[model samples]
Target: MRARSTVLAACAAAVALLPAGCGGGEKADDAGASASPGAASAAPGPIPAIKPADVKPLVGRWVGTAKDYFQFTADGSGVWVRGGQRLWSGTAIPEGGGKYRFSWQGGDLKTASYWGVSLTEKNTKLLFAGTNQTYTKAVAHKGKGKG
Candidate 1:
């Protein structure tokens, strides 16, 4: 009779500990819910493609004024102004790798400009590591139209 009680008590202790052990870990459903869909999974629908010509509309003179105003001409030349000082001026040359090299002269500064990939129609951000400045501006065309 004593042996039977001891076995029953041991089994009860194990059953109580089992719930605590399992609950201590993260729940499987929570992990699955937070996971993102696989990138290689089948496409839900056709993806629209943008051609270079479609991007041509973005090529033009864009001007803006706030703390500073800048004029960016995609054709060949561009300029930026702040506090009556011309911050930048140069010729913009577009390359294949979403990059543009600009040869500029103005504001006691002279050098070639480096522009990264275009972000949007109205906004273009440029980073100058030498100056440690990130320039962000909303551009407006001189007369062609709005972006």
Candidate 2:
């Protein structure tokens, strides 16, 4: 009877330590392993779609500066400059294919014309071309009188 009680006490002590030794780490590892696959399979929400009709009316005059550059326009033709050097002066025309193309004289150099197409939105898109001292810039047409 005495030996049986000693054995039972030893077993109880082992069982108590069992949870402390194995419970926390194994449970955390299993949770982390299972959680990773679930995170990977989760889908991101839908992307916003833009159509040509949505951008048509924006084919007028827009004047705003971006990235420390300034633009001034009358009608669809405009000039852009940065740091007191003229970059380009160009005409913008809607190309009927959800895009607008602009042609302009690049810098003070005659016979140097640059052209590019851009999709219009409530926001403007600015494009930069060339390296170092040689570059061209294009902006989307923004509409109406200034606010």
Candidate 3:
């Protein structure tokens, strides 16, 4: 029962994190990125397919303003961190149309959620359709363990 409650709470947090696009987009600044112009519009269509190579630019540790982050790996696997603690293991599945689904596993969320990406002057920006929050690629990281 405790596990279920935790999962439910986590699921609620995910929903809260993404209230706009429900997931994520890409940028075209000659940098590694993924997102569509209408990706966060009122209505969405089929997401574009992504290649492993294309996602390479997005692979790395992304830090959020409040210390939340995403550590994406080249093998399509990733870890989502919040408040310095590991939240869940995630899979970055590329859905067609410049959209990447950030699905959670081995934790609270089991459903697949998508997100888009955009390149910045210094780092990369990761955005989900629902929430306005963005995860920027970190310049320096101390590794994950619960800060």
**Which parts of model 1 are misplaced by more than 4 Å?**
1-66, 104-124, 139-147
**Model 1 C-alpha lDDT per residue in residues 1-147, reported as the tens digit of each score:** 775565445434422432221221111322222211121222222112334443343354333322344354434345544455554454334443344443312111122222212324343655332222345555543786675
Candidate 2: deviation at residue 112, Å?
Answer: 16
Model 2 misplaced stretches (Cα beyond 4 Å): 1-74, 105-114, 120-147
Against the reference, the lDDT scores of all candidates come to 0.35, 0.33, 0.50
**Candidate number of the best lDDT:** 3
Q: Write the per-residue lDDT of candidate 3 for residues 1-147, one digit (tens) a residue.
A: 775565446545664554333223221122322222233322333334445676676688877655467787776567666765554454566544444665421111222343433434443577644344566777864888888
Error of 2 at 24 (Å): 72
What residue pairs are clashing in model 2?
Answer: none
User: TM-score for every candidate vs. truth?
Assistant: 0.35, 0.31, 0.48
Which stretch of 10 consecutive residues in model 3 shows the poorest summed lDDT? 25-34
Worst 10 residues of 1 by lDDT: 104-113
Ranking by TM-score: 3, 1, 2
Residues 1-147 of candidate 2 have per-residue lDDT tens digits of 775565445434423432222211111332223211112332222212334344444444333232223242334444444445444344444445434333322111111112333433433543322211112234455789795
